[model samples]
Every structure is written in C-alpha cells, then in structure tokens.
Target: MPKKVTITDIANLVGVSKATISYYLNGNTHKMSLETREKIRQTIEATGYQPNKIARSLVTKDTKTIGVVIADITNPFISSVIKGITDTCTSKGYTVTFTNSDNQEEIEQENIARLKQQNVSGIIIDTVDANSPNISQLAFDKTVMVDRQAKKLRLDTVVSNNRESTVNFLREMKKAGYQEIYFVSFPIEGISTREMRYQGFMEEVTEDSSHLLILEEPGVEKRIYDLIQKAKDKIAFFTMNGPTLLAFMKIVNKTSFRYPEDFGLGSYEDLAWMDVLNPNVSCIRQDSYQIGVLAARHLLAKLKKEKSSSSPKLLVVPSESVIRNSF
Candidate 1:
C-alpha cells in the first residue's frame, strides 16, 4: 500500500515552512499571498494529504463536529433533513455523528446524553417528543430543534407552520365541497408533530358537526373503516402519518371500500409512495431538508458565539398543501 502523506510532506514538497502550511490549511490568508496559498493547496491536494482535524481540535478546543439526533431515520422526511445537515456541515469542514431516537422518549434522552459525552460542539435534534422533559432539561451551549417545538424550553427551533398550514388545508378542502370530513389523529401524549397538527385543525374548525376521530393506538384502522361504512355521508378522510394512512388503506382494501367514490384520503407527511398509490394521496408537504439546513446553520452560529438581539427563536418554514384528486 502507498504510504499516507502528511502536511509536513506537503510543506517540504512545496518549499514552505510547516507554520505557513498550517495557516493555509486553516484558511488564514491575511498574510499569505494568493500565489503562496494556491501552491500549498495544490501540493496538499496532489499528495492526497488530509489535515488531522482531531489533533488540531485538541489544541484549538474546537472539534468542528456537530451531533444530530433524529426522531426516526427510516422516515423519509427525517432522512431528508439529515441530508441537509450533512451537506452543510461537510462543506463547513465539520463532521457529523448521527443517532436515531426511534420515537421513544427514553431512547431519545440516552442519545442526547451520549452525544454530549462525545464532545460534539453543537447539536441539531429532531425531537421524538416535544414534551420530553429530558429535551427541556438538557444543556448545551449550541442546540437547535428541527421539525418540532418545545414551548417550555428556551432554545432555537425550526419547524413548519403546523397550525396555520393545517387550518388552511382543511379550510380549502371545505371550500372545495368536502362535507362531512373526518380526521384521524395519532394519540397526543408524547413530544409529537401530531399534537401541533391537531391543534391547528381544531383552531380552524369551529363547528364540531363533522366526525373527527382521534386514534389512541395503531389499531384505529378498524374504527376508520367503521366510520367510513356508517358515515356514508362523509366525503374526506385525513391521517397524520404514513403508517396510519397505510394501515387505513389496508382496511379500506379489505372492506372493499372504493376510493374517491366511497372515501378520500389525505396525509400530513409526504411519504415517497403516496404519489404512486392508487387514487394518489393528497398532503400537506413539509420541507424537511430545508429544516435540517436551517437547524445546522443556527446551531453552528450558536457554537461560534454569534451574538444576536433576539431571544431564543422559532424559525417557521411553510408547508405546501397539494390538491390531488383525493379531495
């Protein structure tokens, strides 16, 4: 195997001192000429020499690494957000360590503690439960929340306008002649996007005349089918997550309920298969990738000690409500 090259080797080949090479590597161009900087960079690149950021961090006390805890890595929305974080962090010469909380409060807490122990300079967390006390109590110099919020905690958070978006979506559906609309929501005990969406719907809806069912568990598919069977007057159905929508679809198929004719389905999370499925699900589409990018930048700013007059802020992204034939 070829021997690994070092910065010293690049310095020697470029006829520059080690200090000069270090300065160039650190992007310190104030004293060095452009010619000299280019020569050192070219030499380093040609030799395939990589800087020892870990060793440098030991002396500088800046690891240049950000730890990220995602609610569920398997979810496309969460994964897209992580991709944004990775792209931004890598470009900024920082590394990322990612952990999955699996939507469990205990697991989420353990992961946060572990990330802190790893000496990550900052954190970008997609909280499993917004109400998880661990999230509120955890202390970090630089932290940002993505796609979730904690009203009790004083921290930077980036999330979509859940209430406004949901309310508008439902209102538009109602205007488009969706009568007897039914909503199926996840149980709201944990730190969840489910809660915000529910709140949004409730605030916009004054009349409780329509059938609105809140699911306490995953087995609410039967209840949905029963409602659809009995409430033949109802025209639309909505679900908060992909799993719930998928389960409901299964029940609909088993019960031989035709789509559009018998019922309509709308989803909150824009899962990949939503478009390909029969009848094509309508949804409120959130920008998870952009949320990730914003969270990373915010946390990095915090880590760099960037001062601002504003207090802990909530960055709200907008959601696009796709009007498919589901309505």
Candidate 2:
C-alpha cells in the first residue's frame, strides 16, 4: 500500500491551518471564506484525504450513523425497504448499520441494544413483535419505527395501511362475486400487522369463523382440504402476507387446483413470483421502500431537533391494488 493521506496533507496543499480544514469537515464552514473552502475541498479530492471518521466523531460527539433493526432481512419486502433506507441515508452523508432480528422479540430487543452500544446517531426499527416491551420504552428522541406498530403507539412510525387496505381488497373480492372469502395467515398471536389484516377481513367478512383459517391451528390441514372441496366454484382465498400466501400456493399446486378458474386467490403482499404464476395474482402493492425512507428521514429530523407532535405520529403509506385474474 502507498502512504495514507491525512487532513494535515490537505491542509499543507491548501496553505490553510489544520483547524480550518477541521472546521470544513465539521460543517462549520460559515466562518471560512468561500475561496478557502473551495481550495480545501479541491486539495482533499486531489490528495485523497480519508479522514478518520472515528476520531472526528469523538470530537463532534456525532457518528453521523443510523442503526437499522429489521424484522427479517430474508423477506423480499423487508429487503426492498432496506434498499430505500440505504439509498436515502447514503445520499444524506450518513452511514447505516443494519441488524436482522429473525422475527423474534428477544432478538429484536438485543439487536436494538447492540445498535445503541455502537453510538449510532439514530435508530430505525422494523420490529418483529409490535407488542414487544422493548418497543414501548425505546429512546423516543433517537428512534423511529416502520413496517410494524406497537399495540400502544409510542414511537414515530411509518407503515402501510394494513387494516383499511385489507378491508377494501376483501370488499373488492366480494364485489367480484367471491361467495366464500377465506383469510389465511400463519398466526396473529402478538403480531400487530397480522392482527390488523385479520381485523380488516373480519369487518367485511362478518362473523364467519369458518372462513378465518389460522394455518397453525390444530387439524388445519383437514380444514384446508374441506375448504378447497367446498369452494370448488366461486371461492377466493385472501392471505394476510407473503409467507402465508406461499404456503397456501404450495397446497394449491399439490392439489392441482387451477386458479381463477377452479379457485381465486389474492394476498396482502405482491411478490415477484406472483406475477409469473399462470393467472397473474391480484394483490396489494405496498410502498415498502417508502416506509424505510420515511422512517430514516424521521429519525434524522429528530436528531436535528425538529419540532414534532406531542403524541407519536403514525404516518400511513398508501397501497395500490394490482388487479389481475387471480381475484
């Protein structure tokens, strides 16, 4: 390796004091002349002076870094959201450190603690369990949430309209003459997003317990088979999320039941595979990327001491319906 370039080298090349160079690096350039600042910047570029961010952070008490905790990075939707976050943060002169909780509450809590230990300027959490105790008491000034919402809202959150959108989508299916609409999901246990989607289905679906199928329930396999037999005509299944939709599709493939002809299906998430499947699936297209961008921006605003509402605000990102033969 060649010699490392330092701020001192840039200072020498620009004929300016090292403190002046430091001021420019620290965003205190208002005290310096434009000519001097331009020369310094030019020298920095020419010399390739890579300042030690760690050392600078020690002096400024700011890392200019954002910590992100995701529910599960493996999921395509969550990954897309992270892409939006990375793009926004990188452009804003901030770096991102992301952690995946693997959809476990304890892991989510531990991840947040670990991120905090790194002295990140702010945190953006795509939570595993919305009701996690860690969520209720997070450092409000330095944290923003996305994708998931707590049972009791305490953090600034940006999420798609889970409940209202589901209601509208199910109503659309009903309008299309879907005599039996089944809500298929993994489990609503303590997950607020799943529960909200389930609630939306219930609002439009009435008190028909038979149509609400929890895959984790005992004898669910038999119940699914029975449902498939009953709805051989004019039956549509509304899945709560991507994973649930995948599971149901596996069964559909195994049973050799063709969609939009033998049956109809619609899901909450619009996945890539859903597009290529025989009759393209109709579903909700949520702006997952926007959720990530908004969450990071909100955290950045908090760090800048921007005025926010007394109550934690829930920002809803709109969802677009991707209509196709599946519904």
lDDT of 1 by residue, 186-255 (tens): 5654544777787776776543734566556655667767777877464777777777787667667887
Error of 2 at 148 (Å): 0.7
Model 1 stretches astray by more than 4 angstroms? 1-3, 12-16, 31-36, 136-140, 190-192, 207-210, 217-226, 230-234, 306-310
What tens digits encode model 2's per-residue C-alpha lDDT throughout 70-146?
88889888988898899889988899998999988888888888987899998898888766778865788888888
Q: State the local distance difference test value for candidate 2.
A: 0.85
Cα RMSD (angstroms) for every candidate in the order listed: 2.9, 2.2
- What is the TM-score (0 to 1) of candidate 2? 0.91
Say what the RMSD of model 2 is.
Answer: 2.2
Whole-model Cα lDDT of every candidate shown, in order? 0.78, 0.85
TM-score of each: 0.86, 0.91
Candidate of highest lDDT: 2
